[model samples]
Target: MINRRTFTALMAGTLAASGKSFAETARGKTVFYASVGTELFLYDVDAEAAALTRRSSVMLPAGVQYAWPHPSKRFFYVASSNGQPGGGAVNQGDKHYASAFRVDPATGALTPHGQTLALTARPIHISIDGGGGFAMIAYNDPSNLTVYRINADGTLGALVQQRAKPDIGIYSHQIRTTPSNKTAILVCRGNNPADGKGEDPGSLKVFGFNEGQLTNLASYAPGNGYGFGPRHLDFHPTLPFVYVSLERQNKLYTYGLQLDGTLSRDPLFMKDSLGEPNNRRAGQGAGTIHVHPNGRFVYQANRNSAVVDFQGKKVFAGGENNMAVWSIDQKTGEPTLIQTADGHANQLRTFGIDPSGRMLVAASISPILMREGNNVANLSAGLTVYRIGGDGKLSFVRKYDVDTSKGTQFWSGMVSLG
Candidate 1:
């Protein structure tokens, strides 16, 4: 029995089968990705598999650290984290720019659209609005967000609005929007544990976005006690629920949206039960969190178990290098641990819930490409397709490899297919 969603998805897929016009194929399409030491590779998703087919990559200009494909998919942007190692994060005095490139569908090569756009802080994050007319970005240094209007040709306009320091401590970790597309949330947290209190505390700030402008709607200073940082969030597809993934403390916080648009914190503060003395180590880093399409399950990736913060601080909460699963209560909009050790490090960085909510497409990151031999194996680069069992357990159905060995470390990042 084909449902409307699946039926609609098939017709949409057939029409945009060719990777010709990015605008036509970017929506509702899946793209495979692997992160090299400093580069990103993109592949068109295979019709019936998680494997990548049309391989393409774009170079991050010198000084840039990392970037992601814009939600719009018309352009790919990369942020220049630093000119040199430990360059003190691109402060305002510096350019702190974003590399804008035209995503070539034929070859997958990124063509420079123009000079880098000046950003308020280091470009750790960028996102497009629901209307697809504007972009908002979060900077790591000075901690700010800037708005840029999107041109019809996919180029970014001038920085229309620049928001600074909604929170007192830590840098801006991530900037994203609500499903309604009426508001945006900016989560603050420090990457390195370098603050007066030995821990950089952060806050979650919400803003009302209208006509390409941002207005301070409200904010919640969960206090430094919420643990190191709150970086990413996953919104339930059917419920007004959201899950926040913290980095410093390496914990998960759940929230329920109120009728007036305020987010209320959940009573249950869920933390991984992996390591007793948990610490922040890239090997055991809390990569990402997402709810299954059906809204009944939530999952997260753990990178390592050592000190995750560069300041030599232990993550202390989540330490194991595996995948963790939880059952989401629809009524209360909370999460309860269901499974752990689902996959390897960097595996959760990029994965997608199956359209039916019964499965997921997962990938792992390979850290060996840094000339860091396979012994330590920080990132386990591979692909896994898992279907959920009746008990909410994750079961592997099929797995894929980095088809081409040349691209050693194809660390997964974002997974989406139209």
Candidate 2:
């Protein structure tokens, strides 16, 4: 049943790869928001290099802020970041608006689902528990948090819980789910800063969840010294450890996870102080925090710090740029800075580290100086690949040809927490 055209096409591919230069593949059902517009692409991880492919292109209703993928990869929900359809800003003093979209995994397209009228204030981030039964949404416009039980067909059910004032705001940044899948954590920045240099510092809050219901558990308020501004947090792939990124102080903290489903303050926390850039230390910021798969080190995007390296298990105050490197103190579970990663912009949204903690993929939430010959013109956004050596040093791999417009300025992340 083989046709001539099909045979010719197979032969052409085989002949083209006669000797060297082979194509690699990726594994896992990966999804990321095509922030600028619609059309979400999928990545299937194989073994070595990731094979670029599309499961489907979703044409959203436009202005779709972010999407939450189903753990089964069978569905996802897209939400409005600004206002709802027919129009109304997500934030208008005391008002709130948000919309949802149903995703068809088989075809890779999005369909309008429902709208929440005056439900949430500037609803931005959404988190689904590991059990795949419930969802928690962070409404920053009104500094609130809400949870909803999901129906089998993807329609949201009753609004089981709602807490209007989260207290801390410049901007309620993120809501995260813990490994136990029983707790949802919220991290946020100060109100919209008119100056942009980043003021006020952020805070962290944890809410207990059960059978799709939420219970206010515990929260962290950053006092003076530590500069409380917390952003993204990454759970270790192997250890019972969690890493949090501090924006105002441009620092990192490794929190030891407790058995009762909370964070422990045992050895206090691991610290890494990013160095100055062009002698300007005040503006140096931090974004996302991610731990290497090895459980031996940690990484954070130290903005404008150039790169900071100190004793990840002990020292700080000096180092280099790109990626802030560190070593984990096994006995105390604290971090000691090792070296500064040398790469593009310090505006890394978050990084994906391999299971071995040996290879890495970093995305620039902003601009980055591209390596020679790897420049894809205006460089749109940077995707730098790297290798974490045995000594814990990060070596650059390759940067992809990208469209910088993909960078999210008005929005936080163009990705799903899954």
Candidate 3:
């Protein structure tokens, strides 16, 4: 196994051989990280030119589900598990953990920083407080959340003992801390309408945060949480607005953030995320959402990569697999659909925009068999890069394919170097 000192030395040698010092090359550049199976890759991204180059890769003990960087940009946390995403449910397993890594400020290289902590259930999402004081992990199978303190050296401490159990609703997908560092929000995506099974209402669970303890604050749901399957949410950089992506309803909603760190009772505006909203298909639903760095635009993904039998062979079902671009009004916090860019591949599970807001990269999770004009071909897993214009519209630049046959490209994000 490669230790922290060895990895740092190897990165320094690599930079020296290329005649580029780490301090000179990595200051303002953004690095894109993707977790494919057990391996994590670092890609050097060019915002002005809209291109990406894979730099290095490191393997984890298990398959990665989610990752979040520290507020200081000096550390990163990853949740891994032996289980995988089944056809319609999560494949259960015993191995689950949260690992801390030290991120090199000048080189973007990641090295193991502390002891890996064992988790009772597979964590679906992980995030840190804005003050970098605590690490929060959310599990969906049992619907639980855990908190770990951050040591002075940036390593993770033991789990904080909880005095009260907050009501973490069913199927929690994402967790985030508010800008004030006084509140935490969990997006609970309820079960979709299925055969002979009634719909399970979804909700946004909010809690008050003080130091490392949590107190249940409020629960916000439209129409008593029915028909409100929220998968992910992103807050505006300078406004009191929260944008959410409804996974089951294929819609986007905007909510007003109150002064006391609680969300409003109802949504301020709701809009369809699909291009052909009236023509609903079988596998059409929303995926991830992100707000632009400038706060002038918001982006969400619509994925429908279901392969079905066609002409006695399995092929694409021909539904929408694209990214929706919405221009945000600064005054009223309303979002309007400007364009829907084709994702070139299938099932874009996650994506990230650079801090400069000049480039966007979308990750297509798995490969699928699709019909290309009359011939059927296997579309490999890949990452698509786009150039963001001045008006917040995205233009396709290029795509780099990956071999995800071993495991899926589960999560991807971009972090700025310190």
What is the TM-score of each predicted model, taking all chains together? Answer: 0.72, 0.68, 0.92
Instruction: Please give the CA lDDT of all the candidate structures.
Output: 0.59, 0.54, 0.86
Best by TM-score: 3
lDDT of 1 by residue, 1-418 (tens): 2335543453343233222342433345555555554456676655344344546666554344445565555677666543332225343334466767776555445688867676545566676776667777776666667778777877777767445333333577578777656678887876544454465566777877777777777776664444657777877665566788776566777876543444774324556634332444444456667776556778876554333332333222234655678888756666877777456333345565544345555665442221122222233456666766766677766665554343334235444432
Best of the two (2, 3) by lDDT: 3
Please identify which of the two predictions, 1 or 3, would achieve the higher lDDT against the true structure: 3
RMSD of 2: 13.8
lDDT of 3 by residue, 217-285 (tens): 999888788989999999876667799999989999998776567887788899999999998788788
**What tens digits encode model 2's per-residue C-alpha lDDT throughout 287-389?**
6666665557778777542323223221112223368777876545577878777655435555565443446666654443333342322224555667778
Candidate 3: Cα lDDT at 101: 94
Per-residue error for 287 in candidate 1, Å, reads 2.6
- What are the per-model numbers of colliding residue pairs? 26, 30, 0
